[model samples]
Target: MAGAGLKGARERRVRTGGIELCVAELGDADRPTVLLVHGYPDSKEVWSEVAVRLAEEFHVVLYDVRGHGRSTAPAPLRGGFTLEKLTDDFLAVADAVSPDRPVHLVGHDWGSVQSWEFVTVPRTEGRIASFTSLSGPSLDHFGHWIKSRMARPTPRRIGQLLGQGAKSWYVYLLQTPVLPELAWRGPLGKRWPKLLERVEKVPAGDYPTPSLPQDAATGAWLYRDNVRARLSRPRPDAFAHVPVQLITPTGDAFLSERLYDDLGTWVPELTRRTLPAKHWVPRTRPDQLSAWIGDFVRTHEEPATRAPRPVAEAAVRSGVRPEYAERFGGQLVLVTGAASGIGRATAFAFAEAGARVVAVDRDAEGAARTAEMARLIGAPEAWGEAVDVSDEQAMEKLAATVAAEYGIVDVLVNNAGIGLTGSFLETTSEEWKRVLDVNLWGVIHGCRIFGAQMAARGQGGHIVNTASAAAFQPSRALPAYNTSKAAVLMLSECLRAELAGRSIGVSAICPGIVNTNITATTRFAGVSDTAEEKRRQRKASRLYGLRNYPPEKVADAILGAVLHDRAVVPVTPEARGVHALSRLAPGALRALARWQPPA
Candidate 1:
């Protein structure tokens, strides 16, 4: 208990090349290491939160790069801040720190730029297991885009004004004769955070920016050399072989996200994430940032003997296979109304993850196609059956057959449903029954049959029901669809409460308008085959004015709910607004239902 991980970390000083870097060593040295590199005007203290969390599993190495923090900055610092020079500094640090093993590298802001260059270098290629770039662009691409865009008057004016024009005061003072060193060592000693606020526009309460004479000049020199193209450069294509993860902060005012638009083209193994934070995302969102890093490291950074093929090589040399959740592998997954759209996709996601998928749909061939995709994704087994989930006997028999063949059901996705688009007056009694039968009754049947056995056996399981944004906020044009989905939401909530003491979990997936075959399946009061009639139907659908998301994204959300035990999974931004509307003003929402195509 005394050596209870990083609760007892040791601090030390190490020489990386010419610089004496201050380093903190945490966790067991035998575990895979995480090299946390700090950015400009900041120190390794920024990674305190992340280090503490990762220390339970990883050997965390936090170091102040070069001139920043407690590191010694020798004379003639101008030539030492180039990207190549920074790469040398990182390589030196890694060699001194973890000489025997490949390390997982994570960096933010200026450190991200350094990590991007360091990981792709031929000499350091095998030394690094994976790289996580936070709030930094690919240097070559950023340089190219900036240079190309500066040719235009408007953009050049904006770029120069923000990057150099407004910063001339501080840049001048940093390059000044006598004032900088005296100012830093004297009255400006404790005012580095406030000074950075005025110059970098970072708020005082945000990330702390440490300052020193040599460090300021060395840090600024990176941009100076970049603008002048004075640094040794590798072709942008060099990074294509490296495994890179990018986390972009949407609220980062200084950097434009457009820099990563063509990122996939450069690094084929790129895993991109967008966080809702400022430029100093690592300091502000350490928990989320560290979680992503942990996942990347755990997945990729095994021992050298078990060194997984770089994702880039695995992608090109062979076909990339879908990775499955632990609950899905070789286990039975039931998907209802699997003939088309999200049902088809849910079956495929499970199959791709190596589950024995049972795809049931009223349409025989459609169900077969879903089953086929599961097989293509290397599922342990896949079965396609034509059965109406609303039919109790058919669902019971389907459940029995799956149990007989695949042991027990572990995951059940109730995605079978039909959509109706018309006002309450326009919707007939018969139409209401049909929609309810498929959407509400279908989920009820699946849960009752499969869930009973799962609860009886005392084996934990998951249930996913496909509802809609309309469930919470009724759409003016689709009363029947809204009512059916509303029932599904309540059903899931009630099931979750009943099964809470048991190990069973339930989720209601509320999706916004998805670009699936659902709209095509909407049955008009009278059937039409004429071109004009079809054109009018298409036009009405267009007037509905919904953002059509892809089926895959919705499927991902569904799977995420099961894996994470999330109660209500809302797919789109529209769904979020609907949930808020229902929460704040129910009366207003009900009144607005009279409005045509209420968004």
Candidate 2:
């Protein structure tokens, strides 16, 4: 049976544990099955976005848990929502959907909690090829964690225990007899959707369904049935048999990052991914979830002949810094002007963090060299593309090719720019146009083309635009350069505000003066002869050499900005000083701008 507006989805009802489960299927039945599970107080619609994405390559399945969505709640639901019954529901669904093939299990929140149980139990070993867990921990693992911390009673462990205890305040309330049900049936249920939208930045849609009040009321037993029982008498033998991937939202308010500290002891084959998102990732970040789940399932699926796949070099590389590896690993990153200067260094930084890098530059050889070194540095894959960022059509083609070949870019660095130096009176219109085209319009094109893809993907990504300290610290000799960088800085701030709701981060990296080749090629507005221009270039390059700030440091700042979601970052000492001065003492900066540098 299919609802009229349910699109191409096929719906079925399966009787499991005396409850009729509402199940929906998509894509070809012959393909491997990917079963997506929703969390508490939510229905199958929670996975609608992610399910469609996965359906492109796999047989996608989604079902309401025992009492949520269209599924009928068990009579006298107090003890009916145990992990055992949940596992039974999973088995029934798997047997009905793909009896001969194991399913790839992906779950978020309470779904993850139950799926962890499914993966660890011996009965479901061959039925589950892999499991991807998000935002929820196994109650058994959580309980053991609590017991160990309490048993040890050390200061650090106590702090962790207390921190997690604070986060789990809702669990305590949920366990109370009629209070939770009454609240859910009252104003709380009606307001929950708005609350999720405001707090988690989840886009409004047909989620939390009309059945939310009853679903949440009946689902309270999920905590009552399993939490205390599993925690107090935890199973020591609860270790996962199938491959497991953990996707952690760094900004989740309900779960502490420290909860997974001992996860390795339980999961033998584990891959960890961290996202700069809030709790409801399936709703707010479905694209990223689907991408990760697809990759994990494809890697672990049983080949027709049971042949082993070769381990990838990126998987085994120890070059990535430990802090960055979890966040950037397997992510696609594109850097413009990556042939040299800060762009190349930034590309190398992301590559070293295990991202797949696409290096773009007008110089083909230099771009190729950067890509080659990026592969050696630890990128899972790297490519070089020769494109001028100032050309709109070239950038559009580049964006299409990158998406078709490398998947959507998770991080975009609009680092391509040029240098121009001259007084306002002497700078010709052509010189101003040249600088603005590359510096301002280049950033605009990158953001318009690539940033749109990121937003349309609905996964959320980060964009880094290379501005200069001249954006803030006005200078007499660098009028055109300052104006272009100022526009870039303002664009970044505006984009940051606009994209915050989309979970896309925009950062303006303003480095004062770095040891880069921009100075060697900087245009001198008033110089008429080639020799004079060369003399000016050498003089500027020599002056910058004396002040020598490495581009590598600027690269480090770029990565840090992405990690911290920083808006405007000043890299070098003088940059930071000038930024401070521009804000704290604007008149002083204006006075300093009046001083003319040697020609």
Candidate 3:
């Protein structure tokens, strides 16, 4: 309890600047050293989940800043928590732990604030090998950011300044004299963990140890001692001397992504990473943070690893959005119905973002070909699985095999479905059941099986269900198809609501019509002769071809839906128009649905 789940860790103390800093070490010391620094209102235990993970490959070190956790508080708390003093504590810890080797530095929030000081200043230049900053900006850089905006004062700059000012309301609060201390030592501290659980979606656990109250109370000095002084008279020469990896949580409540727009000027060797998470990502997203940190450390530690492989360069050369690469890199993505058309295109899109892809379809050869091409496109790893999504036992087996071999799926795209064009009375019971089985039940099976795994993992994920514009816009000729798609749309909405608390996003993709093989294979119900069904299929395919809305566009929409966590997405102009009509003029849609198409 005291260490808050930092098992098998060896602890020691290093004296610096009139205080003893509590340092905890894990893994082999002879390996590369990775030193982790904690943020405001937290302790070394804040890095417990991440430290243990990185320790598998490197010597991981975590320490309490003075006056936090088990570390002795400064005699005079007012003047003690300065960046200057914090830098000294860092050097002392580095020297005590890895005296001969430079340590890779990682910091979150206030820890990142101080670590920026440790990396930029001349005194600790050679001691730090690399710096990874999360959720915190160098106060010096922030100061410069403010001055540039004030000097230009353009409309956009003014808006950005106002937006950031609003987010910093809490910073203004912390500058208050005794209220912060009183609130922390009183009710606020008691409710902080629950507050994080509700607001940040940080999982409940043994964190924010009992020392939190005192830590929060004294941590107020972190802002007080440094903010005003550094912002007003920021060092002109404050530039990072080490390779820097800045991991920005796009949804951070405090910092704006715009804060780092000009960061390239200050950090010469910079790698930017973004995640769709909140401010407290160290706890909420430790797995991702650890993976990024370890990868960065390894690349920096061994120069041979820094050279870009052909696969690593392919995404850039192929012109995928950099944000997608940053957000989805190394994530596991599973796409159902991936043998051809929209499903294949969607799989390739995610593959281009560096996701490990699992392409599932009934056609084993087609699925394997999709997987092979996906790896060539940019995916680090990919595999093909043959299974009919309508089969529940097969899906269960697929899920189990994927978990055992590949890992928990981070994104599941239920893009598999069938085409059935027939009026309700014309469609036979067998035909209706077959359409619903694949078009509706396939999505149901994938969601029920894979979604459970995501929720149970508790790390959060995305689920995309490929519904259709027929879901909202009814047509007599497409009764069975519309019924099945409508069910999927409603199911996605319901799942989205239920999974909101778990951080899982569910999206229903509704494309009006696209050129895909489904059209050529659609069943024209009530048709007795095989020749008649073939003619109908040819006519439908020709009509779709004349419209010429490519499946690639629908694939792009699916990626965007997952990226933005949209509830319902209409891809093409026709789909958008129908969606609007369904909402605004339902009777108009009904009239249109009643009109028969040319035979």
RMSD per model, one decimal: 14.7, 5.5, 4.5
Top model number, TM-score: 3
The local distance difference test score of each candidate is 0.70, 0.89, 0.89
Please list the residue runs of candidate 3 whose C-alpha ends up more than 4 Å from where it truly belongs after superposition.
28-32, 95-102, 126-129, 152-166, 176-182, 298-301, 305-318, 330-332, 356-412, 444-463, 472-477, 489-507, 512-550, 564-568, 572-599
Tens-place lDDT digits, model 2, residues 515-538: 999989898888789999999899
Q: In candidate 2, residue 492 scores what lDDT?
A: 99
Model 2, which residues run further than 4 Å from truth?
A: 2-6, 303-318, 329-412, 422-425, 433-463, 468-521, 530-557, 564-599
Worst 10 residues of 1 by lDDT: 314-323
Question: Per model, how many backbone clashes are there?
Answer: 0, 0, 0
Error of 3 at 232 (Å): 1.6
Pick the winner on TM-score between candidates 1 and 3.
3
TM-score of 2: 0.77
